[model samples]
Target: MPKKRQYQHLKSFKPIAPVSPALSSSSSRGSDSNAPAKGVNELLSGLRRSAAGSSSASSPHLLANGPSVHPDLRSILQIPDTPPPAPRRPVRTRFDASGRRLPAGPPPPRSWVTTRGQDVDLSHRMRGLKLKDAPSDHNALPGAYLPGRGSLIDRVLRAIASDWEFQRAYQQYHLYFLPNHLKPALLRHIGISGGGVTLADLKLILLPPTDLYEQGELEADSHTTNEVSYLDLSRSLGRSIRLRDVTNFLVPPAPQVHDTHLEDSWDAAVDATPSPPRALLPNLTHLSLALSPDDAEGGSWRHLLDFASKTSHITHLSLAYWPDPCLAPRAQTSKVTTPQGNKIYYGGTNFYSHSLDHDWSEALLVLRKLSRCFYELEYLDLTGCGSWFKALMLETEHDHVDWAVHWGKVTDLRLYAGFPRQEDMAAAEQVAFAEVMETAALVERHIRHMRAGKGRFINVERDRPAT
Candidate 1:
């Protein structure tokens, strides 16, 4: 090593003052008479003796080794035998991410660390599958997911990747149920477009159970737009989640449900409450029901139509093919086995609605019932609806329909003229247009009556060629 700077040039070491007062007094009294005197100033004065003669500090023979005390050293003091002082350390400085030096300050508050983030998972809200092995199809909805078996999502992700790749893959993975736990994450992943999600995107979302989800909070665009959430609750029953629970988060357009067979849910929705309106979705304004005309007269189908007739808040109504399949020409019809093992037929015993002429299907009767039930309806969407213009004109002569009431409040009436095959389309189109013109005349007549010849109150729209 190099030369020790001023560290080696010290007088010979001596013992410190004794800790025991009695021993110290006795030692001092004895050292004066027997041993050589060891004083502090004498040691220092002697060590500096050579230093005073040298013109420079680079002297090897800096200290003298002897017991002789300096006689001229007055003001002597006791020097304790201890190691030299430790070298001083440089002060540390902190800097921000932008390389700006931070000033000294106290540590951050505990709340800053403990506060929950947007990504903080609500363990209780998420329900995971209990598969013992990896599933064949990761995207497929699990047949069943039991509780208290640990998080299925986490277990599966860990099995496929290491810790570094874990969370990244989780963001990319497709979950079965749209968990309320990841709403913010989902919105971020999908991104915001327009002001909110359009009707097209609403069909793509996998709605979670009714109990766990909140409607208003789940609005994709954070605005009360017509972003309808459609759910098929026909397969789920007896679970903790009920259909009514789906209404908790409803926005302007209520969530659509496909549970046509459930009569109690239908009754519950329309039945009036004593105080706070017993309707599941109190703010519900739009509803689309999938119906089939073939069901028994006194069954759930009738009950659903009845319930729908009494509905008041729903201003926009759409008759759709949700609960049942579209009425397309087929060779054979499907059969359903009931709970009591009784097999109900589709084409054999059921009344199938199919015709080449202007014979309206029995299902179209729902439209008349809807018009009667929802007298104050503002919008009636029949874009995806089946045909009934011809039947409406034909039935008026037999049944006395209050035409003013049906077409009076209606501002937007979309009519779908479903034509038959290519061979008869020319003839069918001519008939359909004629019937449409006839229907328009009637709507105009009712409007004129309601307005007392002031102005028109309706827009009759037929199938326009898709761009």
Candidate 2:
């Protein structure tokens, strides 16, 4: 059962009326103090409405149309008008895992490659620029082909001209016209079986007359024959041939005399014969001769001397005689006695010997004649000439032979032959051989002493090749 007590306190409570609002101290003390004061009920009711609107705006559906908050309260509450920026995602990339950039469009097609040894095989493929052929329907233009064709032609022509092997063969073995009669011998001598000869080889093996007028006159007077003549040489080997080297190739045999008296006087007459006044091969420079003393009845040397005397432009001269005392002395030299008038003898086994003094004097005469001819000689190689060359140098040292008239540009002089035969010399002959070699060594020393301070490339040596 429910108790109905506690009505005693409610019976005493009576209804009370609302009170008016009190004025502020500033307003009450103002000159408009008599103005009416607002009731507190109106202020209380306005505040109640604002509180109720705030609570309703908290709902998500009402937030879009919510009432504006007070300016002072909005700043305190830190309300944001704009929404937060959307979270940023990583930028998409076009690069692969290996860091190489992928293509923006479709991948290119693979290219087929061929190698020289493969003969146009298409097994290998790669990516590159493609070469396309021109259309066959287009008519060829002259100037259009000229640019590419001319450039290619120019490259080929330049390569052909600059090729060393081709140029050397052309310059060294270029063909020339030759006379039919003399062509066989000349070709055989030059080791060529061809009908013609080269300018380089012809100059060394043939001799042309010094004067063109004399050649022309000789040609007009003479009839065609089977012999080689100065006119034949001039006609075949032109003046364009430059005579640089005069070796043993062109040495002619001594003139033959059928008459007995002429044969008796031939030696003196040939030695006294003067050299030609006019020179041959004005640009002739090198003279290399290796001959025996008994060649062509001992008159072959005269031809070499005559050839040398005509040229004053010789810069390199090498004269070598066979059978020196240090070389094959026993075969060439003998102590056998012979008649005074009969100096040469065809003894047993084709052996001949004159007095050693006579042989020395003959070699001296050749050296003297050659010394008087050349002035521009730079290299003098007297190797294998025996001790006679040393005697000539000794004469020059003693003022008997002219030194300044012959030598000025001689920077290289080779005297002694580099051979091991000296070690095999008998003790009895070795003493004399050493003495003779020492005399030759003095010449090399004297040259070095004189040309010491001139700052030249002095290559004066006794034994060449460092023997």
Candidate 3:
């Protein structure tokens, strides 16, 4: 009776081979009326005894390897010793001076020197008004409230504008085109040292004389600040804007031309460029200056003028010149003399020959001086530069037969031939064809490139790609 009780409990052990519900039910149904039915306890006990005998016989072999574990336990416990390491931090695109990572956005626009402890944004607290959207009030006082028009808003502006700290903040921020009377005050604040404006590019559009006359404010505080139209004060704003016969606009103080190792190829870097000009902007990266009427060779860019009688204005002047020093020394500095015997020096891969109404050679010459000191220039916009650009191409083709003015690292060039109410521009196909041949030199000089990426070109016309 004791042995029977012990075996009865053995029936509780799980089966070695599983009897599925389907098989169990089918077997039960078929066995009825055919054979004696086995009781659940008897079947389970029999299975348990058979499994025990088999396991005992195999026990020595199984123990030789290790105690045999249930298949379920094997899967649960066995894991790869070296699972793939936790995923690493993603790669970084850029870092700040401190070497910490910077999230992607337009970089803060200040040189290390100009960026102070606070690096405050001047316009952020300017009563939530955008300068561009501010309504024009001719009747209002220039920098403060007009004597009798003392509205609440005017009073507020007077208070803010009068605050010396606020004015300095505004100048530091490069605010532009305020009341005509306010310009001199701001310029005084900006002083000889440019308003801590650290812009990457300075684009100046020399509006035609016609545009200046219409502004009517041509003489607005012109005597005090020497600024032309409202836009000329953009020296306080961008890095760029329009110039309307403004002789002494508030440009940054002239800086000594720093030696540019402006290297593109290893060879150019080894051979440094010489006679760099005094740059107005030591920190500016790119500077674009354009004259409005490109075809106005008969205007300020007059090619027929007596070189001796008239001083050459730079805006209408174009000459082929190699900015890269490696090749500059090799170029024989060519000189052209005016009737007055004053030597007009134009050599070293620079050429210019376009008729103009006024001599723009002087104005454009300023850019040549600026280019030498411009560090890290990426884009050069010569659109509306017309003949001037042609002149540059001509000069480039002379020495560096394979390239056209690949200064430092200019990559994207925007060239457009446009004049308001002027004759329609050339057909797209025509411009495309010309551009293909013109840009060939750039393609060839790209120096072992599988694809042309030295610089990209954005042409005029609505459908043309801005690549």
How well does each candidate superpose onto the true structure, as a TM-score?
0.32, 0.33, 0.25
Q: Pick the candidate with the highest TM-score.
A: 2
Candidate 3 all-Cα RMSD: 29.6
lDDT of each: 0.41, 0.44, 0.37
Candidate 3, 88: how far from true, in Å? 84
lDDT of 2: 0.44
Per-prediction RMSD in angstroms? 20.8, 31.2, 29.6
Give per-residue CA lDDT, model 1, range 1-467, as digits (tens). Answer: 89867756787578766589888898888887897776998989987986776633333332222233444442264432333344556556587689998768754677764554322444323323224332222211122222222355544433332331333336333332345333222222222111222222232233333344577555553422223222222111112122222333232234445554545565567533334333423444555432222321111334444455445656665543222222321312667788999976543212344344333433345445655677766665543234333433334333323446554566766554433224445876666655655565564455446556543366766544435
Better of 1 and 2 by lDDT: 2
Give the residue spans of candidate 1 off by over 4 A: 1-277, 289-310, 320-368, 384-386, 393-403, 418-456, 463-467
Q: Report the Cα lDDT for residue 307, model 1.
A: 57
| Candidate 2 worst ten-residue window by lDDT | 126-135
Q: Please give the distance, in angstroms, between residue 95's alpha carbon in candidate 2 and its true position after superposition.
A: 45
Tens digits of lDDT, candidate 2, 308-397 = 655566677655443322222333434344666545422211122223333343344555666667767777666555545454544423
Q: Which order, best to worst by TM-score? A: 2, 1, 3
